[model samples]
Target: MTQQEKNFEGSLKIRLYNTKSREVELFQPYFAPRVGIYSCGMTVYGYAHVGHIRTYTNSDVLRRLLEYAGYQVTQVMNVTDVGHMTSDEDAGEDKLELGARREGKTPWEIAEFYEDHFFSTIAECNITRPEVISRATEHIGEQIGLVKRLEDNGYTYKTDVGVIFDTSKFGRYAEFARLDLEGQEAGARVAVDDQRRNPQDFALWITNQPNHIMQWNSPWGRGFPGWHIECSAMAMRYLGDQVDIHTGGIDHIPVHHTNEIAQSECATGRQYVKYWFHSAFLNVDGRKMSKSLNNLYTLDDVRARGYSPLALRYLFLNGFYRRDMNFTWEALESAQRGLARLWGACAELPAPTGVVIPGFIEKFESAISNDLNTMNALAVVSGVLETKGPPESKASTIYKMDEVFGLDLANSRTRLSDFWRLRGLRPEHKMQAESMADKREKARKNKNFSEADRLRDRINNMGFQVEDTPQGPKIVPMFDFDFAAMRKPVCGHCGVDEKTGC
Candidate 1:
């Protein structure tokens, strides 16, 4: 291995809380230099809410950190275009079909519209796209093959409604969730699917009713794959029978992820995934976000409220991924001001022309290494700003740190410049803004409070806000800029700038 690889393997120990193990452990890739990751992606039945965004953002940070640690990482995310039911027990209507009926559109149209919206929303948060995005509708053959493997292995049984996985056959069925099988069997919460052999058994394929819109040919007759099977099939097809990591929301643990472990392990006759990572849910105003409560905030909703999407991203980083984050408008507004302050500080620093300060990068790496503790990593950023150091070294170190934070810190000046140009300001306006900002900093250092306040007010009246940071005083836009309007839509699948639409 090269020196860089040795450094990564030796020093970059990332400890993560594995849901399956129910404890934090050192992350060891199944393979040496290459790592395979599979994250459960959007169902595309509706616009992605803030809860979904939080999950994806956490996954994105994990991927970014791994790549930064000198690993060749391949990430595959599955888009559930079909076969996801409203109820996790597999009794409710298909989510896509339900969305189609609610929106007065075809199922395919509903999937396409929301899929586009999903990509657009994540892009606003600067999320890195996955290397391979697998769609369930496009991988029907693979899903069928997986069901056949399970049946041949005697892990499935025929049911009147569809083929179902025999959870009892898998001895370690509830090991991950530690479920109370007896309680579940005795409770009324279990869906009454008479076809199932046991209360905990879940569907592998669902025989479509005559009115169903999305159906495919299968040995079990015309039907669709189960929600859990789609993820297993697509994940194995792209990554392998076994992967380094699998990630999803905490809601997936008891049913979806447990079922995936049972069926995938039985079919492959090997360990399915080495690490299972789950992110906590986002609550709104100390209550769960529900459509009936009208508190399901989307990226568009944040934009409508004049808060940048990155503000929400920053808010997520403030809390640990495994800890529940409560979202209030008040919290979001505080995060917006926090992000503006960061941008303002970054704007004041000159372009990085010095080498990275020794010990600074190591401090950051250590913080994230400890169970992806982004909250501590953010605190390290604050420490960097407060430390007595050359501006060049601090700027360079922060630019490197943005690889994991994804805050676009290095381009703060460019973003501000673009905003000014879009507002019809000339180049001289930027020069004038910088000059006045310098004068304000000098006055503050000279203890001229009145002069400093006057200069600050002058900058604010010109549509710019001056923020004082540990490093120095900096300037930013008076209000949040519409980052989505700054660029045209780019196709997530095809790397083309789609002027009309993706």
Candidate 2:
């Protein structure tokens, strides 16, 4: 075996910060050489913003590192097409219904449309798709089965609204999140639901809400599964009764994940997850991203503002996943420049000779093993670029590092051209125009100006003008557009105009 292969063999212990334990713990799968991971996925109510991208990116790195460490990993992620409500608690409108109303479409249509956007956005960021993608709507039977188990175990109570998981029956319900049960208020964040015996009790099956757009016939009634129940049900369905790692946003700690633990463990009579992995929130301009502030930037927003989605991924890696990271246009610009240079350096390297610098590989592995310390891992990548070595060795080492980084460094040649063209250009429009331009280029090659003109006209209709340059078609937006300002919706939470910064 090559020396680099030897380096990755054994003695590579991974440590992850378990939100349940409140400390970094050594990661040992319950079953050797096999790891089960379940990451919380998009709700598919709207466009996946940059905040969602950061959490999924962190999850991707975790999965990639496990694979790199030679573990047979089964990663399951859920698409929350239904059940997720506006409030984490059962006190608000169904988010799918809300989105459907806004778009003048059915709940299912809204789900499919936004789900596609989520997948495409993550792809642009180079996040590896989970091996199993479970949708809440598709898994309704499983969700109902889980609720039945909870009911049979006497951990559930029937209410006018539906079947509610009785938090009082679970002794360790608050241990995962360390809740001050006595001090907690019932209606602090969401409206008080008197039907619940305890404020902490969450719904397992929601019923009696005739207005809910997405409904299913369940044992409880003709209703739907609750938001928290879907995750627990879906996670157990694919990854077995217990998962090695269950990842989500830190905001889920107090409510969403805490309820998941309560219901799942109570029903199964065993621990549901060994480790709880949570990523901190991504703030915009040092403030919480708010619709009122007009800062909930989506992947398309990032691209529309002349930045590579991969560059946004790079910015995310520079910060610790457990700590809140602030986002700004300035920071994104810096990330784009740094990524461009790295891609450029890779492009200039000599061809790989199937030799990886062992030292560099070891350091990169060490950083990722320590709670996915991507910021330090990125620093090690910088070190590899500067270290004196045979060019082939350096090239091979960087390529190996890309296994964990997922920067697409192996295709830096294409990225260099793509990245350069993307700068100072609205990437979303440019991307759309470029697709048409490519067809137009093909048509022109075939001496078909009429078809080329048709394609050009389509591009123009989409508010983009294509310039046939020596390099290729240069796509420029016909008008300078402040896409961000166009997204300035009234603050859904604060009930104020965004211009006033409520």
Cα lDDT, all candidates: 0.83, 0.84
**On residues 1-502, what C-alpha lDDT tens digit does candidate 1 reach at each position?**
5554454566477888888788999887876568899999999998899999999999999999998876789999888999887765565788999999999999999999999999889888888888998889999999999999999999988877688899999999978899988776543865577666788888888885667789999988998888889899998998889988999999999988999999999999999998998999999999999999999999988877767788889999999999999999999989878877788788878788878877878888889988888988898888888888989889998988889999999988665454345444454444555678888888888999998888776665455677778878766555544433534443322212456332
Per-candidate clash tally: 0, 0
Alpha-carbon lDDT of model 2:
0.84
Q: Give the root-mean-square deviation of each candidate in angstroms.
A: 8.6, 11.6
In model 2, which regions exceed 4 Å deviation? 1-11, 88-91, 424-502
TM-score of 1: 0.85
Q: List the residue pairs that clash in candidate 1.
A: none
* Highest TM-score model number: 1
After superposition, the stretches of candidate 1 with alpha carbons farther than 4 Å from their true spots are 1-8, 88-91, 185-187, 417-502
467 Cα displacement, candidate 1 (Å): 10
